[model samples]
Target: MYASLVRSTVALAALCVAYPIQTQASDPAHESHHGKLGTVHFEVACNEAAQREFNLAMAYYHSFVMEQMKAPLERTLQADGSCGMAHWATALASLDNPFGWPGNVSAKTLADGAELMERARKTGLKTQRERDLVDALAVFFKDTEKLNHAARAKALEAALQDVAARYPDDSEATILYSLVLSANFNPADKQYGNQLKAAKQLEAVFAKEPDHPGVTHYLIHSYDYPPLAAHGLEAARRYSKIAPAAAHAQHMPSHIFTRVGAWAESVASNTASANADGGKTWNSPHAYDYMVYAYLQMGQDRAAHLVRDGALSNPTPPDHFAAAFSYASMPARLALERGDWAAAAKLPLTPAAGAYPWAKYPQAEANNAYARALGAAALRDAEGVSAELARLQALRDRATELKLGYWVEQIGIQTDVVRGFSAARSGDVKAGIAALQAAAAREDASEKHAVTPGPLLPAREVLAKVLLDSGDAAGALREFEAVLSKEPNRLRGMAGAALAAERRDDAAKARDYTGKIARQTARADGGVDGTQLARLSVTR
Candidate 1:
């Protein structure tokens, strides 16, 4: 395995050297500070100027930098008023965060997309390929008032699949089809049939167009899960280099990095992403959230704290769900990951309450409440836990009202953790253990949403700690090992396992776990002073 990884790394490095990170545009009209967003040959029956801008827009679209594509798309229309495909691309961009939950897209955005599609049709498509592309997008915007988002999404996916099937040589169609496949993937399907199918299509595109930004970007998304993350490493390594200017491209690689427990790589990827946006775009805070997770996993609490502080300090952070999520999560993660119960309990519900529409984002709001509940339970503050539980219940109710089934489930899991911990603190150890086991089972059964790096704290990790505290060393070790198997090299998991092994008098296993923690924290600032690892004595 080690040899294979090394060989893969070497080959990827060679590819990078061959392609280089930066590519200069041949046309002065195509020149912009956005850097090279990968090569795209989207054939259009427009003027040369429109064609250049349209290709650039397609490149941006492929990278999932939807906002950036707008300017180029507008430029394409400005260059040629009859550019029907440019209008089609504009309509597609309106479906922002295509992987997001149903109804997340605003009515205004949907109406705008419908208008753009009408404009495309009015302008007259020159080719069957162009018409097919426009028509596929039309299915998504068609009858938005009657068709729910999920129904439209499935229809769009089928439409795109048909388009790809008709045009076997069309890389753009194949890439877009793969993306829809990923977006419409059923998380409950443990077989991961859709994701696997998407990955296979993307892999074929990747072979033909190695530097195509969309192919690499969607490949990472397709293989984002634990079972498939290793297969995404090549794409992850190449994506940032392919589209260095795209903040999403810079950050997207960390999805695989986080899944594989490549903490240092995850930190670097998110850091570059954050710097690319400079805290102006939602991507900055999103990247910061990932940074906090990666830093915590590496035992770099001080760095994680700095990232949290920096993200929170952004005065005009984008007023969107992604930014709000990061604002709520970064501080909570910083407090909770280090087991700082007091800090976690004191964390404010919304850092900048008036900055964003907090009411619209019940899921984001639930993060602080969830953290506070866990912290209160850990601190043995039954009343505080109960108070936070009420807040979580209210948020869960709001999520249910919004028909956000995923957030409802997530909030339920948080509530369960708090109740279990509170029960244990109140002298019902058996009940607490049973509650935690149920929570862990539920958590294990489902996949986390793309918005989070992981849960604020994984349920199994909480269960492991509770078991350890209750003197079930063997049980604790088992749970910790389970967590590490799925989320390898987590500092807290390694520390918990080491301590549990120590308690069980398994010195060899204890030493092994401790050594992993020491290596992970070797470059950490101020060392692991307040972390669980502080309890273990690791001899170098």
Candidate 2:
């Protein structure tokens, strides 16, 4: 009996070892910490008295929840300049945010960040951990001539892994490491093994500390892919509440919501996110972009119009990376998503200042060209279509030159789609169908980025519409089905499917698809218009 009790105790201890809970080392009230457990430490560079302010800055940096962290880090500096860790934290915060995406790191900011890192190194850290942190960052900052961003990121990842291993009790280290792991993943890779590994680490941490900002924030990123998006819904739902003051925090939840086609939840999340920082922060534009997309998906035309109109009329233009992306994409989304040919034709060619560095990239510039191509095709302006197609080809070449592999591929797909539309409009129906078929195949192989709404409408959806117009009912049905498989219950996909079914005289399938769309539309706040439904021959 005693041996049995000992065995049970050993089992329990093993379980405890596997999932270690963070605990207060001393008085929680005075600890230099952020997060739920207060495990974050800033004593490496400062005395206990000033640790409070440093902890506050560390908390924000750890979560990647803010649109900008310079203000908080500057506050930390004000509280204690000798705090080498604060300087280190500032440099870390200024780095191009994870996910290989654009952030607000301008040329001046990059120069300042390098200077700050040098300052941190010279200040001389107190703890081995502090020294180690600086040493890891030095790989990224000290020698930019030798090490590229990709090499530096990988080196930082290795260093963080070592940090987490050295201090298993430090949940902050583990969570940070997990974030880098997730961010370094190739966005186009469908296997998702790296993301899955990161998710497991974060999920275990989340189980113990549900309110840890990093845990919730990274979990949402881990599952941002469409295949994995639903798994992040709970985190998405909780993140905004956990970090209510963070504009990006409120917006992050909608990533999962948009993936799952939960329009109402998406609308609510983006609305809150956009307003969280008085709608002035860089994150607000992202929120507005998502909100408008959600509103349109729900058939809330008025609400979508309100959001778009408000964005265009706003006197202040966003200058940072996040806001710039939103600024460039919002109007393009408005024109393409609604099939507003006139608006598309008139879209401004000049990009805003916020999108400065990346504005010229094909990925960012493709939207305007896409709008022009569609508008020209709809108007049967063959010359206009030819010009847009040429522009797309040039953009593809530029993407290749820049080593933007993903954008190169994406622009190629766009070129094909544009060419297809141009061919069809010019009365070369067969060539158009073939070009759209190739475009759909390429699109199907690629995963959409989390930032934009549904690829300006899926290529397959467009292909199906074109086929239906060409009287290829069976071909149209196949393409529409492909879209519905990937995006279930989508209004456009379902409507196309129903129309294709009716064309084929498959009354039962047509009735079933029409019934599903009706039921789905009925649940929305404002039902889809009867005339729009009639145009597709899926009458109410």
Candidate 3:
């Protein structure tokens, strides 16, 4: 088995060599920066073919539209095997944690990337800049078992920082450094220290080249935090226009749109993303996920239902990690958002064949478990809740084994929330309340998932529902408000707040909240259903 794997690895490395496209040097006049491609210098073997492919790969990489990079980088290698920097770029794209989370990479991806980097090292880069960047990635690939996640990430960040400084004229380097900084951002930091710093770096580049893919793309990342979301709106609006070919670029604007409660824009953005790649890219599933959410938020039930049904019936082999996660999470999200507890309860626990090995990433598994547990609790099925909690614990164990502390903690929070919801359903109010609150607190401290536009069920939203069920109107209102603060105009959060206010005898507050929902929904196509609106005494 080991020998077979090694042989396959060698075959993959040699595949690029089969399609060499020998060509003349590029015209010097055309070397100047263009609309979105910009002047990206990788200092390869100094051939036109090598430079062209390298720039294409860099363009995709800079925009975080990475899966598309493989072909171009492969071509670069084929054109000039000694264009070692092209190999390094390939490794970076192949190894990227699509979701921007620490410790989220699959073991297979890590090994593949490390193998590619080894090939690049053996081939040897032509420039000091390429060597430095390649060596930095080497740090991440080294002794995977020895260095902890933070230590490895910090080392890579340090290397990227040095590269950025070494090539001050290279906007691509600055963009890359900004990405590292943004990925390392902590949500609990109200100041968003790292994110702000990243924003400054990206914005400085954006000034000189408004259409630069990396500047627009990384700027979105830099301001993705809730506190800085407004700052990202411009990038979000422009990135797709600048790089329409990239599915991820089309979908990126929805990040800010979702944050700011612009459901219409979110829907449009993801729709473009889903279609841009003909629904074939790894980005398609992710685009569908966000599209469903946006449609649901707009109270366009039929649209949301069609989105979910279409994806489930026409299942694809989620070749990308983000696609795998989206495939796993979509059904659960649909059921939970619609308050269809029975449907969620019946969701299959195991991933479908061809799905990205989400089982290797505990967070993806936890999404399904969380939905199941919540569904079971809603149905007052203690046994079902217990079963799901066990599944969650097993997932936590896997994350622990992988040294994925973030996921371990996240799954733990879900477990607690499930247990608490179960307890509250069984009349253990005090313990249930405490546990649920703790879970919410823990979740709030963690960074948001960078892959999806937003989580289907924020922990605070769940806690608020629990409080409302227990008749703790004031407590429910507090939780709902917290959710709204982060996700303005969220449908369920708005409804919950209105309901809680009514229960608390705040008639004026209830009117205000319900009116907001009505106004928001009115702007949506066909508006919200009259019955769901009637539930909160909100009318068209």
Candidate 4:
């Protein structure tokens, strides 16, 4: 099945290259020219007007700009009500973030998707490829009430695989097949088999359709893991330029940038995304979170604070999970990353009214408790730490009750970190270290969830800090280096390693670590302190 899909994808690519398709109409007033959302050659069975609008909708669909795709798709249907593929595209867009947690998708949305699929079927798709595409997507909306999201996703993946096999020269089918594979990737699978398979197909498609937005965008997603991040650099750098008008495209590259610790590039990409039209709602908060993370990493705390404060003051941020996660995480990250334990401890448990639905997202709520617990531990406030620990436990229990699988585990991990820090602070150093090690091991075994850029503080980095404080310089150095191996150029890891080296009389190693920090933070707005630099002059 995979081989046939690859062959078909290659053939489609050759066709696209030989007969390049114009992505936009020459008429300035035409609604078909939404943005430079990349090229696609989906020849629909519709009138010329509907065809142009359908292509524009397909472009936005390829970039995962579902909201933007809707208007153009509606325009397509208005132009030619008989265009079945337009209905198929509408249903597909309704799926909305294939990897999003199922709970976020309401029953009404599922019912609507099913209705859209039925409408497409009623049109009697003119071409075999169009029929195949509709049939494959129909599986996801079929039996929506009977089958769970995972079950439907699995069925959809199988259906897409079959479509790709049958329509070998259908580039759209091949690209979508790759996307399903990526969406279905198991985070616990250390081998990254699904992601690599998806990337293999995408790379083939990319060779022929270098300007295709979906190819580049999905490729970055496939390689968003630490082990595979460098391989995605090409796609990461190209996607924004290819779909410069897409706010999501501008933001998407930052996923790779965050994974690879390219702080400056991440800051730039997210800044552009945040300044785009989508900045008023979910995308702005999302971009600001990444921007805050990058700014903090570069020792630019002043800039990071500006971004965080601006996002927080947005009177009416969207009540979406993505927005909530970013809004909750930005302040926590700022306080925790800067070692402002007091500030972290004082972080509001929920955003002000009209900001977001914090109650709906337990994971976002957990961020406040987690940061507070860690801060209390750092301050040796045993009572404060215990209270915050209880809050985290309660949040975890709530998440488990809600069947939020990923957030449940994440909260559990946070609980463990807090327990470890509290134990270490209370002089049960042995028990504390053991708890931290267990948490770090569990963290290292799993990949980060898509919703987060990373944990507020990585388990390993916390363990390393505890080790250094306990005078186990060698152990601390080992842990810090381990973190740096996976997250290259991370500021805290470098600083910790430098401190440990200095404590162990390894001046050369300390100097090496400090030099890298100096270069990375050369453009900083003053956040790296003397202690963080381990008393070594970064210049020397």
Which candidate has the highest TM-score of all?
Answer: 1
Name the regions of candidate 3 deviating beyond 4 angstroms.
Answer: 1-45, 78-81, 98-124, 349-358, 523-540
Better of 1 and 3 by TM-score: 1
- Pairs of residues clashing in candidate 2: none
Candidate 2 lDDT by residue in tens digits, 386-435: 88888878877876765566667877887788878768767899998888
| Residues 243-286 of candidate 4: C-alpha lDDT, one tens digit per residue | 87777888899999999999889977877776653345577788
User: Can you give the lDDT of residue 159 in candidate 4?
Assistant: 94
Instruction: Evaluate residue 407 in candidate 3 and report its C-alpha lDDT on the 0 to 100 scale.
Output: 67
Ranking by TM-score: 1, 4, 3, 2
Which pairs clash inside model 1? none
Q: Model 1 compared with the native: what TM-score?
A: 0.91
Candidate 1 lDDT over residue span 162-258, tens digit each? 9999999988889899999998887677788999999999899889888888888888888888788899999999999988877799999999999
TM-score against truth, every candidate: 0.91, 0.84, 0.86, 0.90
- Residues 1-540, candidate 3: write the lDDT tens digits: 644553443243222112211223333224432444443554566479878878877877776667767877777877787777877887788656434545546567667878878888788777777777888777777776787667777777788898899989977778778887777766578788888998999889889878778788778877777778998998998888887666678888888888888988887787777666555556667777887777677565556666655555544445555766677687887777767888888887434644547656677778888898988987889899989989899989998987767668878888888888778777887888888888888888876777766775777877787788887899999999999999887888888898889999999999998888776665343434532643442110
Query: Ten residues in a row with the worst lDDT in model 2?
Result: 13-22
